[model samples]
Target: MTDATLAFAHGDPHQLRGMEGVGIAHDGPAPKRIVTGYGFWIFLLSDIVMFSCFFAAYAVLLGQTAGGPSGAQLFDLRSVALETGCLLLSSFTCGLATIAAGVRNERWFQAAMAVTCVLGLVFLTLEGREFASLVARGAGPTRSAFLSAFFALVGCHGMHVSAGILWLLTMMAQVLAKGFRADIQRRLLCFALFWHALDIIWVGVFSVVYLLGSAV
Candidate 1:
């Protein structure tokens, strides 16, 4: 029944006003994707705020080298560029995966997720090499406050990426086992948002930590 009709039928607009809604059925649970996405968005915002604090700390400590090597001496821009490219490509593949999930295309979804997983692994591998080379050259996090902050800021991001890779693999396995269930699709939505958030954070990291660090 219409809102007005329902109100008249109930003989009380006050009761209708206090209710969730008069026209729509309020008995069933909310769509899982909407609820899940809202919760995940809150989580992603909290994560971003945490990262912002780390960024702020790094900014404050950027000049505190303690007689150790600096970004110019330590960062290989080419390697960082490669890492950035891999993550960007992974984001693209993740987008494809989301699209495929929405359309219930199992093959394309798995393919896209696989590519994203590979790209993420490549980014992590390059990052690991970068860290190793820095340690080998006596530029470890323990060497200086600047190095410490750098590792804290970037390492946290790396850990998030690692988690995302694991999540992606789990989703792939779930899709293979359970097919395109609604719960699984909702999970894919959350994963896509998380992966995209990493891309955004990386842009800031490259700008503030890598590009500006090397120049200034």
Candidate 2:
């Protein structure tokens, strides 16, 4: 082959090998994605610490009824059962949504995510109504130390669920706009972790505040 033809066939040498002297700039001191993930982990750890403290406080205040309604008098196991089922189903839907994202099935992802969010909202609504009814019946947080602990522990968990719903909605918007890109998928996974962690905490609350408390 002629020299000119050979060079044309090869194309730009640097281009073929990849960009030269581009020196892929580090966006900042730390890689943006790695730093973001590390920061999220730290936040989750801090949350764990907070939950631990709440758990300890609840334990200490477990039997302090102060002449008010005790867990056996106040807790409705049937309602708690329903709430637990709903939250568990929501967690399942969230998993399905993540799977849909991985497969790049936008419709399934959106549908599953919407279902998850709806279920989460339902759980929160039920919890709020339950709290309201209790308070209306003169069993509010101020009723006794036990009630106060109950409200704080369970209420904090409900707040986490609320925050998670918001986060899920935000991620849904991102997915709709950008489609399931890697970064967005990662964020969704993290949100899933957070959601499931809330479920775990609820299990503990249910056992300590409802089941065991009833037995006592």
Candidate 3:
């Protein structure tokens, strides 16, 4: 036989011996884990692109007050500041949840995630109330181009938070049922990244849409 064929014959062509008797090792590189991470990152990038478009639209319409209420007149800086703090704290707790997951501390992970979800819900509630109050005062999105843009930007973010809350609950269920399996851990990681990204987006909203609105 040729040298190549001899080597292949003698060297375990299937390369299965190294993984013999080890179930986890037989799994080999965990393609699911790798793909999960990659797919989640791609999703996050796409989400960032979507948010960028919203930001650009807001920028284009920032000054289009159209004889309606301006941001300074409609925005409540104190409320915005409170919402910002809640989101920031939720982001921090989400980080803690991820850390707990990594350590396989299911209790801490679930608690942290629960806290994050509650804070996210509170933020959304405040935002909804603000919108309702605006509409009650005749400052709805249809009132002007600026209000339209404002509603689009802030409302899109609230929707994201709502989605995150749903995801958090789902993850909690998974943790309770599965005890932080590898796939569950991967999903939690993705959720953590998404939740934190929403917090960062809210920071931008508060700064550009609220703080600057107050100043200008």
Clashes of each: 0, 0, 0
Off by over 4 Å in 2: 1-39
In candidate 3, stretches whose alpha carbon ends up further than 4 angstroms from where it belongs are 1-31
lDDT of 2: 0.85
Clashes of 1: 0
| Residue lDDT tens for model 2, 83-191 | 9889999989988987888899999999999999999988998899889988998999999898888899899999999999999999999999998887887798788
Summarize candidate 1's per-residue lDDT along 118-147 as a digit string, tens digits: 999999999999999898988999999999
- lDDT by residue (tens digit), candidate 3, 1-216: 854455457886565444445442333465776788788889989988988898888878888988877888889988888899999999999999999999999889989988998888889889889999999999999998888988998999999899899999999998999898888888987898889889888889888888876665
TM-score of each: 0.87, 0.81, 0.84
Model 3, residue 78: C-alpha shift (Å): 0.6
The top-ranked prediction according to TM-score is 1
Local distance difference test values of all predictions, in order? 0.92, 0.85, 0.86
Clashes of 2: 0
Q: What's the TM for model 3? A: 0.84
Find the candidate with the highest lDDT and give its number: 1
